[model samples]
Target: MKTLAIIDYGMGNLHSVSKAVELVAPDTRVLVTSDPAQIREADRVILPGVGAIRDCMAEILRLGVDDLVREVSADRPLLGICVGMQALMSRSEENGWVDCINLFPSEVRFFGNHLKEGDVRLKVPHMGWNEVYQTTDHPVWHNIPDGDRFYFVHSYYAEAEGNPDIAGRTHYGIDIAAAVARDNIFAVQFHPEKSHRAGLQLLKNFVQWTGA
Candidate 1:
């Protein structure tokens, strides 16, 4: 059986993400664990998270999931979701300034206390559905259409203006890095588990992808 490990660093929505993965790929074994051995041995790895980058990074490092994620990402298909995606960056503007794993050379920036679109004021969290524009072609974008809406619940997003690794972009009050892809690593600022159809399709694509 193909094993897919979702790193449980005490920050992610582990149950929902594992269930969604199971729903998309029933044949694949999904493990929600912090065990380094299981993570390394799995065919695929998923890093899913919610909440602040500081707390997330603390638990990740404490559990040694940071190293395990990096190790697995080097060889197998690894998917990061929500704050999990933010954790892959070099730094986050949240909680003053916290350093991240730096898997991708980027920074997580806050949407700002006072954001606006034209005349209307926008919320900081940027909750609910928003369209994601595909910046580049990728296997993860398989059947997922460009300009499709995905569920977002974040106040901070990875900067994507000139980053070459960025695969997708979205807008609220600013340009948000919706997705980033490099070799075997694919990370998203949105939660696929809660994103409905298009999100499920993206997860399915990841399940079948060979990281090519």
Candidate 2:
């Protein structure tokens, strides 16, 4: 069985993500790894996190996993979840705005903390199920239905600076980024593992996607 490394950056919900992948990709070995060298050699890599963007970046950098992330992202199939997804952006304003992994040309900012900010009725960090609308034509959403409900638990949102590597979107207060892709790197702002059956299906589809 080909091994898939779920990075143990100590910044993500590693146990749940590892279990989800193993459930869907049964034949494949899902190894929760902290060793950068092992991570580099894995068939596929998952960067999962649920925390501040700055802290996530710090953990990766301190562990030197950022370099491995850069290396793998350049040549392999990589899946980044939630804050991991935001980390791929050019910059984030979580702690006074700082540089990120730069896998995509986008910026991350916290949801406007206003209950009466125009169409933004939901609370900031938009918790719970939200419908995602595909932003571009990609193989990942090949069989996935449009406007599919996905579980979300985030305080910040991503906005593409240019044409952007956007893959899908979800409306909250206003339209917000739901997913994005750039070459071999793909990510989602929501937690597919926690989204129920469709979430599991997303994991299944990703395991068998073939990076096509």
Candidate 3:
């Protein structure tokens, strides 16, 4: 049986993410845990988190999940969600600059208090559904179409800065890296569990992906 580990380091919507993965891939064994052994043994690893980047990184380091994530992501399929995604960057502008795992050569930045689009003021968190435009071909985009709306509830987003590894982009007063992929890792700034159809399809694709 296929094993999928959802890393739980005192952050993230663990149960909901576990349920969503179970819903899409019922036959797979899902383990939501912080144990390094279990995470290392799983066929696939999912790094999920919510809340401030500072607290997220603190827990990740405190639980030794930082090195674990780096080790597992070296040659296994790994998915990061929300703050989990931001944690893959070099640093985040949130909480007055917190260092991340640096899996991707990018930085997390705030939406700004004066964010606006054509004379209309936008919110800080950028909460709600927004269209994600596919920038590169990837297995996770298999059944998902370009410009499909995904659920987002983040004030900070990854600034890929024209990185070739960027897989998806979305506009919310400014362009944001919605997804990033490289080698065996795929991370997203949106919550696929709350994204409905498109989200589920993405998870399904991730479950079946071989990281080729």
Candidate 4:
């Protein structure tokens, strides 16, 4: 079984994520290790973080996981969740001022208070179930259909320019990036495990994915 190292950057729900992966790939060891050496040695890597983007990136740099991530993610499969997903992008609008991870050449910004006018009811930190609208076919979206609902809790969302990297999208008054992927890296702005059975299945597919 393949081993998956759930990165512990001292932020977010790392334990819950490990448990979800364990259900699908029980034989596949799910180790929560912050050591960059251990992380680089794992069969697959899951960068799970929750908090300000700046702090998460800082932890990655401070612990030297940044370099290790770059090394492993080059050819190996890597998954980022929630803030972890945002970190995979170029930058984020949350962390005090503008800051970023610069991984996929895009930036995460606040959910526009309103696209036009007369639309001021949607919550800023989009929380609860959202239906993911698919833009393209990817391994992560394997076996999943369009309009699948997933759990989400975020105030900020991701955006990309030409040559779209968006894989799954969701509507929260304003359609925003629910997931994005590029090469060996795949990220989602929601919590799969927390989303119930559908989400669990998504995690299952990820663990069994041959592409990664």
TM-score of each candidate? 0.98, 0.94, 0.98, 0.92
Worst 10 contiguous positions by lDDT, candidate 3: 157-166
Candidate 1 on 1-212: residue-level lDDT in tens? 89999998889999999999999999999999888888899999999999989999999888878788888898899999999999999999999999899899999998988899998999878899999999888899999889998999999999889887899999887788999999899999998899999999999999999885
lDDT of 2 at 28: 90
Model 2 residue 143 lDDT?
A: 70
Q: Ten consecutive residues with minimal summed lDDT in candidate 1?
A: 63-72
lDDT by residue for model 4 over 72-161, one digit each (tens)? 888788888998888777777785655556677777878766544254576667778888988888877777878989999988888633
Per-residue lDDT value at 206 in model 1: 95
Residue 73 lDDT in model 1? 90
lDDT of each: 0.92, 0.84, 0.93, 0.80
lDDT of 3 at 148: 98
Off by over 4 Å in 4: 112-120, 160-163
Better of 1 and 4 by TM-score: 1
lDDT of 2: 0.84
What candidate 3 gets wrong by more than 4 Å, as runs, is none
Question: Model 4: what TM-score?
Answer: 0.92
**What residue pairs are clashing in model 4?**
90-102
Flag the better candidate by lDDT, 2 or 3.
3
Which regions of candidate 1 deviate over 4 angstroms? none
